[model samples]
Target: MTAPNPSTHDQAARLVEAVNEALTPATSYRDASLLPAVGPTPPVPQPGRPPMSQRATDASALMLTAGLATAPPGLIAIGLLVASGYADPLVIGMICAAPAVIAVPVLAVARLLRGAQGIGAEHHHHYNGPVSQHTVHTETKTRGLFAKTINKQ
Candidate 1:
């Protein structure tokens, strides 16, 4: 091979120097005590909706996990039963419709109860003679596990 070019050798030397400079730390000591103490990061607040409680979040996670874990096994069992001619059409239909049948009445009752809360007798106030009245109305709204109260005077 021919002799290496002087310019190429100089470029390689400059590149090696740059890499070495980049690898070297600005500070001499790598000890942890030399670094500034950092506190735990604060949680970022979400806008719009309020935060869910740990218990509610845990319950939801558990339900989701249980559903995921059980679905495949349940489906496999049903498939085996159907293939073996052990499950009849009527029994299969009932099994398919079971959740809807159980849910309908429960949902209806919940709706009825919720609707009943909005139905109430009107309040009538009558003042006789000269009277000054000051009224303060406080409204409390509960969503999930958190309650927010608003006072209006």
Candidate 2:
């Protein structure tokens, strides 16, 4: 047979080297020179979404919630102004009080969401890519009406 492709030959050689290395047991665990060099793991290639820090994410959530919490009071003030054609002091006071009543729970939700990192099983989305082989995929089977009747008989 003609000589194998150069690239294929190189790959075969590398594969054999790897297999030989794997098969050979370590002879000296106590020898410092024989041990593999320790270093920081090389970063995995993250193809999308620049990483957001926990603090940054928490801050963003807090700001968003704070803005949303202000909306109800703002809308109330606007409604009062439109109805009476003036910014009455009592109505303005009520508008200010509305936010205070709801602020605590809304802020608490933002805090909870921030602290919830790594709390639950990772939820897979369509963009998360193919499921790993280790994951279980469960499906329910249903029989057609005719098939069910035939099986029963």
Candidate 3:
């Protein structure tokens, strides 16, 4: 059967919305006061790591975006490899690992690019920093899934 006529972005949004909507609240507001949040509901100890499921989803999306696993441009490499009909197993192995090898550098460079783009590496308690020193509680604080650059003098 043909796929539904949904915009790519719309389709992704709908999928996420469905999963999020399906998440039943374990506690009512009143019950929350009497019980501690447990399981996946607890705050992440390390702010730089996305939740496991989200991380996997994000990786899949990245692969799709990078064209390593989709579309006309993506098929070019596969077509080249199969067309080559190389006798050397090493040559084929290199062809298969090529995507992953390139991906690592791309991801690394993306992180480096983020640094150039002024994304800080770590959370720090400073007057100019986001959280004030007095209010900085470790358990309550978290940041994004990227590196944190904390420059404490």
Top candidate (TM-score)? 1
TM-score for each model? 0.43, 0.26, 0.24
Looking at model 3, report the run of 10 residues with the lowest lDDT sum. Answer: 132-141
Candidate 3 segments whose C-alpha is farther than 4 A from its true place: 1-86, 117-153
Per-residue lDDT of candidate 3, residues 1-153 (tens digit): 987666987989999999987796655445445564566675647876555797797987787787754567646766676678744658667877998999999999989987785546987544665753444434424477885756444
RMSD (CA, angstroms), candidate 2: 23.8
What digit string (tens of lDDT, one per residue) describes model 2 on residues 43-73?
6769864578989888888999999999898
- lDDT for each residue of candidate 1 in 1-83, tens digit (9 for 90 to 100): 89999999999999999999999988775566665477687778889546899898888889999989998998898889899
RMSD of each: 10.8, 23.8, 25.3
Alpha-carbon local distance difference test for all models: 0.85, 0.78, 0.71
Model 2 alpha-carbon drift over 4 Å, by segment: 1-50, 87-153
Question: lDDT score of model 2?
Answer: 0.78
TM-score of decoy 1: 0.43
